[model samples]
Target: MTASHILLVDDDVELTELLADYLTTEGLEISVANSAEQALALLAPPARFDLAVFDIMMPGMSGLELLQQVRPSNPIPVIMLTGKGGDIDRILGLEMGADDYLSKPCNPRELLARIRAVLRRMQTPPSAPDTRVIQHWGLALQLAKRTLLFRDTPLELTSAEFNVITQFMQNPGVVLSKAKLTERVLHRELTAYDRAIDVHVSRVRQKLSKVLPEQELIKTVRGEGYLFIGEE
Candidate 1:
């Protein structure tokens, strides 16, 4: 098995070094970047990083800025490291297409768990039999390719957004609670005040709306959850 490669971008050299050593020992290939500029250089074409861990508060190019710059072309899963209680940063990171996030000064073990979860979500099982493309309301989700096409026009979605829409489309009209969606999409139990799932769902809606103006594909059920309104 080829070890998953990770790019760790943070201005905290000591922390990056420590994390690199720890994650390396845990069967991951780690590349440390002390700044966002360095991270970009490493992320250039031909670079194959399975995932990225970015610190949100770095000087110069903040992690959010870096994410904005990279997300347009790069689909690599990103996990943002935010300051403790930085709910705003957390939401912003997700809105900017980060796959997951963690509060800073966190346990390395927890980061590892998040990394593994994101990587798992990104993987397609070789022996899996479900390769059929899911088409609903003119939108086609190619399961095997992990791509979406609306009216034969491709939609660029982040990994997290793709997973969210997959859940919605797979169970159309089902009011999937935040807890359920979090479990399925994020591979974790939802915590109180956690808005990660909401942001991802919102992003999916926004993208779909661009190609689906005048139609609301996903409906928010107040006091409940969200439901994908499939073909009637």
Candidate 2:
């Protein structure tokens, strides 16, 4: 996959510039915005950025504020920057549709690693011989198109949701424990209070239910995590 373009939204000009410079050398296309207004301008051309790094404390608009506003319509991946009290903000960000978060004073190398990991998780699956479309109750999952068609209506899904559903669909009729789901989809090992997987699953269930109201497509495995029931 190609390198991802990142937009850095932070009032810390020095840190933002430095991080941009470092990440550029690390193979990511980096853009720095010293304010939320500037970041919005950059994002106006949506395709320009594959992901965003937002700082929690900024002058006019805080990271959380920006997340709330942008998340409703924007589909680009997001990662938040939190110095202290990151725990609470981390959960909020994920719930608001952020893909990940990194504590402040985080190693630049780790940041680079995370950016890469998120991009990798967003990749479209390769074409193969047995890559047939899966249809159930008038909803079709096109593996080749990387899209979901509900009642013959095509629906767009975020990369995170697609990744989670892909993982579940690949293991139909089998139970997926939360731990395994977290590893397969999140691209990182488990962290304390890591409710990222649960959030993704919830989002998927909401979408699936909306499309297939009669089909209980995703079932809770109780002690385990979830299962995707394939049409037999």
Candidate 3:
């Protein structure tokens, strides 16, 4: 099997080099970019990566900006590394379309786990049937393709966002707890004060609203979780 390629973007040259060496041993091809500008240059043409790891706090363009710029045209999964206490940055990163966020000084194992989780979501399981499809109201979801269509119009969604809506469409009107949503969509356990799940949900809502402006499709059940209104 070909090794997965990853772009590691961070201003910390020492940290990026160390992670590149470590991640390489774990069967991943690591491409190093010491700054977001360089990262963009590498991503310009002919260069492709399965996933990208970016440090939230960078020299010129922050990870958030990088995500914003890349997401508009690129669907590559991104895992952001934020400062140890950068809760705000983490949340912002998710809202900006990051596939996952890890606190800086993260354990290599945990980072690897997150990377694998994101990659898994990026791929359709081999066991998945080709004809799998779900249609709710005007929304159509192609499970195998991991694509969604609203009134036959394709919607641009990150893999994480797509997974979140998939969960909602699968169990429409059923309230889904943050913990359950986190596990199902992010493939990770919910942690205390973790708002990544919520941010992803909000992003989904924003996209959905842009497509269906008349009514609210995702409703928040205060103090509880969220539910999808199948016919809103």
Question: Per-prediction RMSD in angstroms?
Answer: 1.3, 2.7, 1.6
Per-residue CA lDDT of model 2 for 60-141, tens digit only, reads 9888998888876888898888875667787778778888788888788888877877877877645463466877656677
Which number leads on TM-score? 1
Which number leads on lDDT? 1
lDDT per residue, candidate 3, 1-232, as tens digits?
8999999999998888888899999999999999999999999878889999999899789889988899768878999999889988888888877888998798888999999988887876778466667888689999877889988888988888999999999898899999999999999999888888999999999998887898798999988899998864
Off by over 4 Å in 2: 1-3, 125-130
CA displacement after TM-score superposition, residue 130 of candidate 2 (Å)? 7.0
To one decimal, what is the Cα RMSD in angstroms of model 2 from the true structure?
2.7
Mind sharing the TM-score for model 2? 0.85
The 10-residue segment of model 2 with minimum total lDDT is 123-132
Error (Å) of candidate 1 at residue 24 is: 1.3
Candidate 1 residue runs with Cα over 4 Å from true position: none
Query: Candidate 1: minimum summed lDDT over ten consecutive residues — where?
Result: 124-133
